[model samples]
Target: MSVCRQAARQWSPFSLGNMPLYRVCGIFALLSVGLISFTPPCDGGNILVFPVDGSHWINMKILLEELHARGHTMTVIRASTSWYIPEKSPLFTSITIELDEALEDFFELYLQEHMRLQREGGSAFAFFKITKDFMSMLSTAHLMWSEALGKILDDKTMIKSLMDSQYDVLLTDPAMAPGVLLAKYLKLPLVLNVRWITSGEGHFAIAPTPLSYIPVPGSGLTDKMTFMQRIKNLFFYSTVVIQQKFMVGPHYDAICDKYFEGGCDVISLLQEADIWLFRSDYVFEFPRPTMPNIVYIGGFQCKPAQPLPADLEEFVQSAGEHGVIIMTLGTLVNALPKEVTDEIASVFAKLPQKVIWRHKGERPSTLGNNTLIVDWMPQKDLLGHPQTKVFIAHGGTNGVQEAIYYGVPVLGIPLFFDQFDNLLRLQERGAAKIIQLGEVNEHRLEQELKELLFEKCYRENIQRLSRLHRDQPITPMDQAIFWVEFVMRHKGAPHLRTEAYKMPWYSYYNVDVLLVLLTAVAVSLYSVFVLVRCLCCRSRRKPKTKQH
Candidate 1:
């Protein structure tokens, strides 16, 4: 037979038109799905972002840029209180508002107080003192924004423009409560970005937090707590709630009343938010209660390190087989006291591993020849490098997430804010050592670094966490984008939201259930007592009748 006839004979039964009607429909359906699978998603919408300016911006920058890349239009409201960089992309819009000087003073004072506390050996009262200072700082920041908020609302032209923007969703950081009000003003679905690992009110807004295991942020307590520690944790959360109610709540309400249309309370408004994106992952954290609205996009902020510049590459490569240690206190901590800096340098000099310290001021005299000091370093690159063995960090969320992403053990020199709490949690994970700046001496620094560098357990634990962190089927970026779009596609993700939004505190906590149970027990006890008394009376009456 000819080649054409043989081919026709072999394929005749599978020909599309020659097949049954149902089979033809199935074949076309398969083709349709294949075409749709490769097709890019196009359901983009206007997304308004409100990230607190200055260092807070860095936390959300990667996610914001990724949103823009995925074709969502973003409008950012930047405050002049901190540094604001206009996004280079055309898809982004920036509106700068002049903020009060209170924020700047707050940070300066915070650093001074933090250093003083660290220098003084920690006491039983340390947690109380630190919590008070942190709350005070937060209060000061809110007052500054309150001043700027009045101006923002007074600007009729700007208000008119923003109102007309017709944004589909409002994304705001938990640090920026004004952003919550802005969402209400725009009448858009509110999505929160909790940049910190734990925010008291933020978690409470989503679901009830059990303090037994979930350490209070900034409490200087870990996930594994003794009975005393749990009591302390309870006290920490109680104090936080009290402060939020008395101090932070009023400020937020006042701002919302002035700016938002409906003028709801901050807590109530927060509950109605569509989704909460936390800067935390389960691998580095204890398993805790979470609702469908909660999503952990922890390492989403971290990216593959770009190629290091020529000088940096040469310096890191020079370490050879010994590897390098990247030490950075992050952008917020611009400089440390010279004495403390000298202590760190002294320890670095003795180690065989090379040190790349990110410091702005003049180099310390005790710094070794193996050490490389720079005004700025590629922190992510250095941490991600194959030869990068350990990271000496301030335990900031950004730095810690990067270390976890790359499976590098950390020698944490905690200063202030959540740094102490972060290191405490990581220490519980067995992948980090917390070196309080106050107690940091030559011996402590040298000993801690040696343990972190040489210890097999540290590396093994971190590597285990690294695998879990990286073993996700979907990239963090994809997961984040998927949820964001899921919200948009489904119109604020009502299905994913919890009934906690609708329930009162008493009902949600099952106080009503407890009350009912108590009532039922009381009724049952009364019935039993009556029956026993009646039986005793009947027995006594029978004896009297027999005597008669």
Candidate 2:
């Protein structure tokens, strides 16, 4: 059994005060010692990282390089995904293959199946059922990916390839739950690095409460269940939980059994990590509720400002002081409908200032001389340029962070998911204006861009937040490194963990306890009142009879 399981079994509800405190402390202390002993000093050493290839992987690359420069020997396990390019640099000590051709083929098949289902017409009920099934299949695919990763770690030949490398710490993205298993199997301290707002709390470090359990922040919307949405959110939560339970739980168990000779809960396995690091500034994600183990190290991915390419810089500078507008929809969702693109192009054609759009394909022939389209651009370099006035973006977290980092006002055309939330937050902070994806037209785009270019307050507001962000005691990277090292040195600090796990659903909200107490008091008072009434009636009847 894992240490957490042992502690849970030993814990007594009635004798909470007289529990074996020393043993608990001893176990935690020993774990802490083991973690710290394995952790190299702040100077950095061998660190093994698992690769999750995507646009977000870019951030990890910067982080790895920063640690490498500080003397860390960085090794990466390359997962074959189109999102990551393994040949980008020679920083990795060794790249281990984690994906098989069969799995890749299966994933492609599943994707095609789901896409076909989406394209086919069906009844409303059928559509809902199909979507749910699709989500389930996608979740299973993710689980399969996690299991495959675990199998790779379990392989003796694979272990031989990695074990000879003499790595110190294992760092990974939290989404890859397999990382937690690998860390446990290797008995290495794990550092969970989150790239976006994850927990329910927007920015507060409080324990996660369900979205329905509290009012949705900023929107003033109470998740008061309207029978339907409640059921939907519940279903959503259940689907996610079930997926995690099946995928993460078994993989964790298998890894533990193979490596640690023990069994453990997936949650405990995750929480057993030394530290949880968030790559976000508190100002942007304020009111976020998280566990004590969680730390905010936002902007760690941000680097010192770099100059733009000479020709591009010259073109932007020569825009005759009106300055150029920088627009990008980010990497994943670049393929906007032709109508949307035409509308965007139409708006840009009329603008006096030059427009530099990071479009994926060929520039439209109708676009004016002032407009430039490129397949890719150095985003940060462009953002930092003084001649760059307004930003039109898809409102990605990294883009939002960069905009705030440089104090550039944004015109956000949020596409989906947290992009909406990020845009909402930016608008609430007076740092940007939002144009819904569905509502984007030439008129709307032109008007919003005009307002953003002319608005002084927007620029000022972003600058204010930028100042606040920069005023942090240390850079996010330093803070992340500190906590990561802290966890390794201290072992797992259970003391820092909150009582969230111990509380029942009703008790967590104090609803059941309050209801029970109220019911008991009401019942007791009613019984007493009834008894008094009976006595009075009997006394009155006796008096009346005597008089008669």
Listed in order, each prediction's TM-score against the native is: 0.86, 0.73
* Worst 10-residue lDDT window, candidate 1: 195-204
lDDT of each: 0.79, 0.68
Provide the lDDT at 294 for model 2: 77
State residue 452's C-alpha deviation in candidate 2, in Å: 1.1
Assess candidate 2 and give its lDDT: 0.68
lDDT tens per residue, model 1, 1-548: 99998788667645644568679678889999999999987767888888876666786777887888888888888765555456444658888888657365668788877687768777858656776887787777777776677787788998899889878888888675778777776678878877441136356556667888888876777667899999989888887778778767777778777766667776677777888887888886667788888888888877777888998898889998999998889877777888989988998999888999889866788999999888888888877789899999999877888888888999998887677777776788899998888888899988989998888999999888888899999887788888787777766877777777677779978999999999999999999999999999998888543553
lDDT of 1: 0.79
Q: For model 1, state the Cα shift of residue 148 in Å.
A: 2.7
Top candidate (lDDT): 1
Model 1: number of backbone collisions: 1
Candidate 2 lDDT tens digits, 25-121: 7777998999999997655566878645565677788878777676666777765543454744667765645455443455445544433443343
